[model samples]
Target: MITPLKAVLVGCGSMSRAWTAAAKDIPYLELTGFVDVVEDAARQRAAEYGSPTAVVSADLENTLDRTRPDIVFDCTVPEAHMPVTLTALHYGCHVLGEKPMADSLENARRMVAAASEAGRLYAVIQNRRYDPNIRRLKAFLDSGEIGPITTVHSDFFIGAHFGGFRDRMEHVLLLDMAIHTFDAARLLTGADPVSVYCKEWNPPGSWYEHGASAVAVFEMTGGIVYTYRGSWCAEGLPTTWESEWRFIGRQGSARWPGDERMQAQVVTESGGFLSTVRDAIIPPLPPGAKTGGHAGIIREFVQCIQAGTQPETICSDNIKSLAMVFAAVESAETGLPVSVSV
Candidate 1:
């Protein structure tokens, strides 16, 4: 019989619903605790997940002590991640937490150091890397049909009017949301950010308190240039949340309209002023590939701990993605290009 790994979920916010739901489907996992600053939130999440008797508490350390969970699922907000992750690692438990890694690079580094000291796994849920289209796109890019990638571009425009903390926060787009896209850029290009120049402004008629719109230019490893133009105040004909992506290479280019289907075109001959073009086939996913998004990342976190391996989004690696976010924010603040580091 399989001995299930007991897991405690920290932070019972709206995002916690997805984590709890995914846990129920993993046979190797057993939900044993739920925690939030507000005990009622924990109780509500526990009952909703059919674990009414689970240890529901307002105190994370106390809950961890009581349950003795083998794993800690951190669904906490950015600022809370540092303490939650440190506490979990201090308990000798593996951790899987939500994206953006931490509120700042210093805190993220502290979390990484704590995990290393504990000798346990700590991975982030950069779930965007697990999408079907992205997997297929990655395969296609590596096939060399595009020759050498020269440039990448993405556009994100959506009027997100959440009248809460986000509307009141500074660097709203870069801090609260742009990290997802930055992380995706890393996954797709298999490159790290070298430096960045960014301009951020709260557009006229914007609903947010600060920095709702921005444009950034990034120099990636391999001399690839990535440009991002985004606005949370854009209302008409908004791009998909995944954002429309275009990757250009010497021989060809491919586009993903932030959707399942992708299209590509390559140069066939050089007779005309512009080289003759032919459609390039975007390949399909490799057989048995798993693109399970949130569930996929959660499963990876558990599987890696059991196998004594590191998951792809482990803190040491994911901090690069987070660095891009901070670098862009710094560039926006200083009005100068800043080196990207973690």
Candidate 2:
């Protein structure tokens, strides 16, 4: 018989809602506790999720010791990821947490080393990786129908008026949001960043206290160049959260509007200034592709735990994505190209 893994969710904030809700759909997971700095917030989440028996507390270590959970869902802020992950791993629990692995690359590296020392699974909730469109697009790119990729471009424009901590944060766009687009770019290009040159600024009429828009150029491995232009305070005609993407390859090119209708074409005839091209069919998601976003990552993490395996968003790889984010920030600040690492 399969034994349900007991889980303690830390940081019962708005983000925790997704984690708790996902836990409910996985029969192999049981909510054992809720922990937040604000004790009432923990209790509120337990009640909100209908996990009446869940222990609620403000102290993470105390709850972990009491609940003796097998897994910890860290929905905490970026600053708390290390503590939450390290504490959970110390308790011999696997951890799955939100994106941008840590506030800094050093901390991310430390967390990775700690997870390795503890011999526990530590994965990030890079939910966009599980999105159906990205899966299908990545599959098509991998199929070699697009040939070897040479260049990539992505644009994210959203007029987010989020009146919260985000408005006051420094390098708001790069730190708070660009991780998704940068990570997605990595997934599509199948490469790690070699170096990045970026420029950031708070445009006129922007609500963010720091950088609200940025343009970054990345030299990716395999000689693929990836560029990103994004503006959180951009009003009207906003791109999807996934961002508009275009991939150019030796034989063809593919475009995803970051929404409905993705298109790809490969050259069929090698004549004339403009070679004749035919539509490259993007294959459907392979059987059993996880497409449930938050629930999908959570379910996969559970299955990996059950099967004694690791997930795609394991800390090691996710850290590379986080590295790109930090590199971009450094490049923007120094007005020069910066190499990415860790």
Candidate 3:
């Protein structure tokens, strides 16, 4: 019988539940401990998901020393991601962390360096990449059905009223939410950003303390342009969490209306003065374990650890996604386009 890898979960916040659920389904991973700054939170999570003897601690170092887990699931806040990840790496533990990599690009780069020095796997979970519709969209784009994509557009709107740190954060929309959409755009286009011009402002009657709505234009590799417009304080008719997408290509256009359904329009004839257009039926999505979102990322993390391979969201690659977030924020603040540094 194969021995399961011992794992510890840090941060017993709302997101931890998803990680706990995914951990339960992976046969090779065993949850052995829970740690949080608040001991009660750790104890509560342990009671809910861990074994009777599972270790719980208010201090991370103490918990790491006691449990000595093979893997650490870091569900901590963005600002805490670096410290938690670096500490786990120093202790010879692989890490599967929540998104945004770290609070800032410099910190993210440092975490990547630490992971490299430690020679342990450190992967960030950009769960949106696992959505079936997104996978289909990418496959369709790559299959040349739409030809070479020239531009892409995405719109996200939501009226979130979370009464917490997010409402007061300075770059609330970009930092807390837009990262997912930005990361998804990269996955869909198979391109990294080169530069960005952005504008951000708070609409009248907005609940957020700082900028809560913005529009950004990004120049990506292969001369592709991606534009994003989003608002966290939208009051009515909110867009789906996945956002609506439109991909413009040389021969056709593909659109995702923020759900599983996708549509395309391709030019059938162009030799004459008038071009004929026909609806392009999207191919069926590729099959897998039918596991997706957070579960899919968790499975990949575990599999990569076992196989001694780098996950798709390894810090080195994920940092580029994070850079887009930071660059857009900078452009918004400075009122000028900024070059993206990967």
Candidate 4:
């Protein structure tokens, strides 16, 4: 019989709610306790989720001693991820942290090393890979139906006034939101980027000092070129997050027009080379197939911990996506392209 894994959550905010809900339903998972700096907040979250309200202490040692959970989930902000991860790993507990892993590349490197030394599973919440649409696309690319892939272009765009926390930041767009797009691009290509060139620009009436819209091009080791365009402050945009892709292969190409319910198109030629174009909408995931970002990510982390294997998408690879994001920032700052090695 499989034993239910105990979990303690830190940073009981909006994101934690999904984790809490998942814990209640998964037979092999249990939400043992909840902690946060704010007592009432922790108590309220625990009440909603039917978990214990441990004293929300700043010291992780104290929390671990009290909760003694097999897993510690760090749903904290970008800056808080490293300390929490290191502390949990030091105590011999598995950790699943929110994305970007850490605010800086140096911290991300240290976290990866720590996990390796401790022999514990450590991973980030990169939930996009499990999306039904993305999974279908991955299978298509792997099948070589369109021949050898040479280039990929993707876009993630949305317009919203984030007044709570996202807007009040120095590097607003890239650091705060573009990680998803960059990570998704890496997953799609199945290749690590060897170098990158990027540009960022803020409109005259933009609220953030840094550019809200940015573009980045990556050169992969196998000569695969990737181009990514993203924005978070485009006014009157009709989508929450519009995901589109253009994949070029030696024989044909595939395009994702950003509708989850519709089939994407794949075109391949049959003359000298097999040239064919067919409307193929990647099927959406079933209702219970893990749609919520944090929910899906946490479930995978638990599975990894129980199975004694690193999550296929670990921090080591995620650092590459982070590299792409920071490279864009660097390029934007210097008004020149920056090459990155991952």
Candidate 5:
């Protein structure tokens, strides 16, 4: 039998729980241990998960040398993803990192090149792309049920009570959250962004040190126009994050406003109809799937490791979406349209 890939997690934050649970369910992945800069946090997390092997990794080089796992998961802060990822690749291990790819496009490119030189699979944890609602939307678009998609719009509006890493961050909205919107836009439209212009604003009397709202217009490949509006501190929204997406095609359109408590619809040239919104449908699970994000992504990653193929939507694929966010940030900074080069 083919041996399961050995996996090591480099951070023990809130997302670690999901990662731990997902790893447990993937037979082809062996969870070696958890590592954190904070000794207590790492030990506590390991105890909570009933894992006896977790360790505090003050020196990553030493830890990796000892563990020699086949796959390294960099669930650390955005800024730290680069060093951890590059080190993992240098040590001849495949890497899967969380979103935003890296703190900057420059570092993201470097990481990509390192992965290429190492000849190992390098992927991003863009779990949102695996969302079932998104899958359903993609299916509808691909079926040409929505003909010649002309316009796309999405929102990541939320009134999050800031804490942890997000509270003390800079460029709050674009850096911290826009990757999901940007990636989803690219995925939903099946196109690349060519040019972008954006306007950003920090809400008056808001607690955030950075801009909280941004609206961007993107010129996508195939002449599709994409618009995204997002805010980290919109008030009085019943949900924590209210995501709305609409695809207006030449012959039809589709919209997913939220889950069951809300509603989604499709309008074709023939007629308009409301999609069946099951009440218990949860956000992370998306819409069409029997299972959801963490589980789905882990399954795919395991398959990729065994098949020796990069996941279709890997970090390299996500680079274009990251470029979109940077383009918007550039637009917001220079007050001019910015073209996406990647």
Candidate 6:
């Protein structure tokens, strides 16, 4: 039988629960250690996960040395991502980190360089891409049924009253939430950002200490234009977590109603003064593993590490998604369009 890859999990915060649960379902992965700034948190995670033999430590470096894991699962905050990833690389361990890559583009670049030097895989978990409905939408866009997508739009609205760090975070919407939609836009359109014009504001009756609403228009490669409107302070008529999306291509347009349902319209035939429009049948999605979200990403991360291949959210490729966030923020701050730096 093949030996399972040992893993050391860092950060015993809320997101760690999802990571630990996913690891349990992957037979090829063994959760060997749990690390957090607070030792009690790590201990609690180990106990909850039934990892009696798992090493629990407040010091990550010490835990890594003790466990000698094959990989490091980083569930830490964005600001700590770079340091955690670098430490893992130095220890000759692969890293699977939570999204947004890093707090800044410069740190993200450094992480990518370190991973390349270490010759180990470094992947970010963009779990939103693993949704079956998202997969179906991507497939439809790729099938040329959309015929070269030229425009895309997404709207996200939610009134979450989480009382924590996010309440006081700056650019809270762009940094914490919009990255999902930005990354999903790239996946669905297969395009990189060129430039973006953005506007950010805090609406009246908002609870966040900083910007909680924003609108951005991004120019992408192949002349594709993507627009985004999001608000974390919206109280009523909140959109689904996935966000509503509309994609317009030369031949047709597709819409995802922020849920599992999708619909498309295409022009069947056209003349000088007349045109015919019909519903474009969306194709069935391909078969995939039963697990998705964090679990799906975990499975792919392990498979890529074992196979010596790069996963979809490899740091190098994921940087573009991160760039979109920074670009939008920069535009909002400067009140001018800014070129996306990748």
For all candidates in order, the CA lDDT equals: 0.90, 0.91, 0.90, 0.75, 0.76, 0.92
Cα lDDT of model 4 by residue, 61-157, tens digit: 7878887888888887788889889999998888887777888888888998998899888888877766766666667776776668899888877
Alpha-carbon RMSD to native, per candidate: 1.2, 1.1, 1.4, 2.9, 4.5, 1.4
TM-score of 4: 0.89
User: Candidate 2 lDDT, tens digit per residue, 1-342?
Assistant: 666899999988898888888888899789989999999999998997897789999999899889999999999899999888988999999999998788999999999999999999999988888899898888889888979999999999999999999999999999988998998998888898999999999999998899999999999999899999999999999999999999999999999998657999999998799999999877777777768898999999999999889998999888989999999999999999999988
TM per model?
Answer: 0.97, 0.98, 0.97, 0.89, 0.88, 0.97
Query: What does candidate 5 score in Cα RMSD to the true structure?
Result: 4.5
Clashes of each: 0, 0, 0, 13, 4, 0
What tens-digit string does per-residue lDDT give for candidate 5 at 1-342? 656788778878888778877887788777666788886666666677665765546567777888898988888888899999999998899888777688888899999889888998888877777766667656656666446889987777787776766766766888878887788788777899899999988888666777788999999999999988888888776332427877777655567774423222344224347443222222243344523676677677778888877785577777898898888889999999999976
Expressed as tens digits, the lDDT of each residue in 1-342 for candidate 3 is: 444799999999989998888888988888888999988988888888857999988888888899899999999888899999999999999998998799999999999999899999999999888888788778888889878999999999999999888889998999988999999999889999999999999999999999899999999999999999999999999998999999999998999987888899999999888678899978888666223889998888888777777888888898999999999999999999999997
Model 5, global lDDT: 0.76
Name the regions of candidate 3 deviating beyond 4 angstroms: 1-3, 271-274, 289-291
- The TM-score of candidate 1 is 0.97
Please give the lDDT score for candidate 6: 0.92
Q: Could you tell me which residue pairs clash in candidate 3?
A: none
Report clash pairs, candidate 6.
none
Report how far off residue 306 is in candidate 4 (Å). 1.6
**Candidate 1, residues 1-342: lDDT per residue as tens digits?**
445699999999999899998899997888899999989999999998897669999999999889999999999888899999999998989999998789999999999989888888889998888888888888888888988888999999999888989889999998877898998888888889999999999988898989999999999999999999998999899898888999999999999988887999999997788898899987679986658999998987887777777898998999999999999999999999999988
Worst 10 residues of 3 by lDDT: 282-291
Q: How would you encode candidate 6's per-residue C-alpha lDDT over 71-153 as one tens digit per residue?
A: 99999988899999999999999999998799999999999999999999999999999888899878888999869999999
